[model samples]
Target: MNNEVIVTCAVTGAGDTVGRHPAIPVTPQQIAAAAVEAAKAGATVVHCHVRDPASGKPSRDPELYYELVDRIRASGVDMILNLTAGMGGDLEIGPGEEPMRFGPGTDLVGGLTRLIHIEQLLPEICTLDCGTLNFGDGDQIYVSTPNQLRAGAKRIQELGVKAELEVFDTGHLWFAKQMVKEGLLGEMPLFQLCLGIPWGAPADTGTMKAMVDNMPPGAIWAGFGIGRMQMPMVAQAVLLGGNVRVGLEDNLWLDKGVYASNGSLVERAVDLVAKLGANTLTPEQGRKKLGLIKRR
Candidate 1:
């Protein structure tokens, strides 16, 4: 088991959890507060996603991102910030015989267009989802083609930001490694093995171990599962010699029938890491572990 753990709290995500949870970090202020709370609860990294403040829907507006980042910075918190570039890829295929019609959820855009905020803000780390997948039981699809990924990777490299490769399955991980081989994501690649998302890799020991086994040499990797598997995967990931991630982005409950805030989820993860006989890393230690220099 890994003795030192880096806990990353994904404060808010693009999922439709705004209405589901009592507190899902809708506005910039709320999201920033959530990040601060998670940091205070011992999260080394705060992975954030901005929302449409008025509608509480996921958004890719650079202005919203700017406001969110500004608030987090103004809070005087000392945690690594990781913004999501996984937005603008949702292609909600039309139901029935009109797959071409595209639903209102469709937000498809060019890969580089998705990184507009990343380019402008230049956080310490940003996510690059490695592949496409049929998101959920619905007809929605998270579209991240190889060409889009290549262009996105190139842009991220040029901006001199650390790319957290988000691999939803083995193929995504495969392509991620290929990007590293092609020198698209710099020398040392950081990976986030996302699991338990529908139609992707299931949350299980075998699958997590397999992904860990296939990670490129010297790859700094972390893994997490969605929903109820979130905490379990934290321990599983640590046991497998990888870091861990937890937060409202991947789950909304602290326990059965109990709602969770970002801070509470992070506290739970920290306690789990300790129980595993490993100590959670501080922001400075985590930055050093990931070779990240805080940039804005």
Candidate 2:
């Protein structure tokens, strides 16, 4: 078990969870506030994703991202910012034979186009989804081809931003290692093992262990499970010699029926880490461990 675990709080995600949870941050101000709260509650890193204030839907607006980042920085909090570069890849297909006729949810774009916000904000870390997957049981799909991932990984390296390779399945992890082998990623690579998402990797101890064992050597990695498996995965990740991630992004409930804020989630994670005889790393220590060069 790692003695120093980096706890990352994914503040707000780009899911349809605004109405589901009362405290799900919608506006830029709200998102930034959540980030600050999480930092204060002992999160070393904050993973952010902006939403359209008017409709409470996921947005790719760089202006909103700028505002969110500015607010977080101005708050005097020293949390590592990790923005999502996984947007603009949604492809909603039509009924049966009419797959060519895309649905309204489709927001597909090129690889670089998805990184516009990352390019503008220049956060300490940004995520690079390693591969595509059938998002859910619906007609929608998350499209991130191998070529797109290669391009995105290379660009993130060029930008001097740490790219957290998001591996949803074993195949994704394999390709992520391939990117490292091709020298597309930086010398010190970062990875996030995303588990329990619909139609993706199942949330189980064996699966998490398998993924953790297959990770590239010397890579800084974090693992998280969605919904009810969130806290369990926390212990699992730490036990497997990896970091931990928590917050409303992956799981909304603090308990059986209780909704959770990002801060509460981080607080719980901090306690869990301590109880396991491991301490959560501070922001500076996390930066050092992950080889992150904070921007501004």
Candidate 3:
């Protein structure tokens, strides 16, 4: 395993995790606080998702993103900000009786409209979910087609933001490479191999290896798994010559019956990386590795 590894803490996900953990940060202030805590715990980057202050549901509000970024910067914690531009592409189709009809929980928007936060805040890194997937336990789908992805990537690139090509499976990897080939991404393409998110890729060594092997040449990448596979994938990612990501977004439990705070999850990943004889990268170091430029 390489001695240098970058650790990213996905502070708050756009999932139904608020009900599972009472401490999950719903408000912008709480999310920023959690991110600051994770940075203090040795995370190189904080992957973010803003939630509605009133309903505790996910939101694509630009003001919330601005507020979170402002607070993180004000706290004086040096960490890379990675905002998600993947939220506004959801398509929750109704059951067979009304398959084509818009469902009750649908929140679909155009690709450009989805990136309002990234456009305004101009963070160093923003996620570009490479393709669509049938999200777990629901008839809902996270839709990101080829054309939609192309538009998102083009917009982020135009803004001089590094795109974290988030790939859930091999197909996503293929599309990401296609983006690189089409000049949508920069020379040193960056990728995040997301594993074990329900109906997507399975959380295992073989699956991780396949994703890593299929990565485009000259690409910088990170790999992570959900729940029990979290720490295990940390080791696996190190062995595979990639960075690691950990947080409540992917896993809710610290143990069998324990709910984990974002800070504790990041601390656990730090220890695991150290135990493997690897040194975790700081935010600045990670920026250089991933070809990210921190713009104020």
Candidate 4:
């Protein structure tokens, strides 16, 4: 088991969860507060995604991201910021035989466009959803082709940002390794094994282990599962010699009936890590462990 772990809290994801939860941190101030709460509760890193404050829908607006990052930085918290570059790839296909008719949910854009916020904000860490996947049981698909990934990786390298390669399936992991081999990702690129999403890798021991086994040698990696499997996968990831992630973005309920905030979820993860004979690292320690280059 890894003795020192990096616990990352994904504060607010770009999911359709505003109505499901009473408070989902739609505005930038709320999101920044959530990040500070998580940091105070023992989260080493914060993965952020901006939402349209009015509609609570996922947005790729650079202004929203700018305001969100500004709030986080101004809060005086020492949490490592990891902005998501996974937006702008949602393609909701039309119902029935009219596949050519894209639905209103479609928000497709070029790969470079997705990095506008990253280019502007220059956070210490950024995520790259390594491959395309069927987002859910619906017709929506998350598109990140090899060409897009290569270009994004190169740009991220040039900007000197740590790319957290998020792999949803074995194929995605395979391609991520290919990118590393091609040297698009700079030395010490991080990997995040995303599990329990629809039509992707399931949340299970064998699946997590299989993905961990396939990881490139000496590659720093972490994993998380969604819903009820979230905490369980925390233990599994640590036991399998990997790091852990947890937050409302991946799981809503802290317990069977209890609602969860980002802080509470991260506290639970820290407790779990301690009980497992391991400890979660602080932000500075996490940066050193992951070889991260922190920006203001």
Best candidate, lDDT: 1
Per-residue lDDT for 1-296 in model 1, tens only? 89989999998898889779888999999999999999999999999999999999999999999999999899898999999999999999988998999999999999999999998999999999999998899898999999999999999989989999999999999999999999999877999999999999999999999999999998989999999999999999999999999999999999999999999999999999999899999999998888888765
State each model's C-alpha RMSD to the native: 0.8, 0.7, 1.0, 0.7
lDDT of prediction 2:
0.93
Of 3 and 4, the candidate ranking higher by TM-score: 4
TM-score of each: 0.98, 0.99, 0.98, 0.99
Residues 73-174 of candidate 4 have per-residue lDDT tens digits of: 888889999999989998998899998799999999988998999998999999999999999999999999999999999999898889999999999999
Overall local distance difference test of candidate 3: 0.90
Order the numbered candidates by lDDT, best leading.
1, 4, 2, 3
lDDT of 2 by residue, 49-93 (tens): 999999999999999999999999899989999999999999999
lDDT of each: 0.94, 0.93, 0.90, 0.93
lDDT of candidate 3 over 47-139, digit per residue (tens):
999999998899988899889889988888899999999988888888888888978678888888889988889999999999999888778
183 Cα displacement, candidate 1 (Å): 0.5
What ordering of candidates by TM-score runs from best to worst? 4, 2, 1, 3
List candidate 3 segments past 4 Å from native: none
Residue pairs clashing, model 1: none
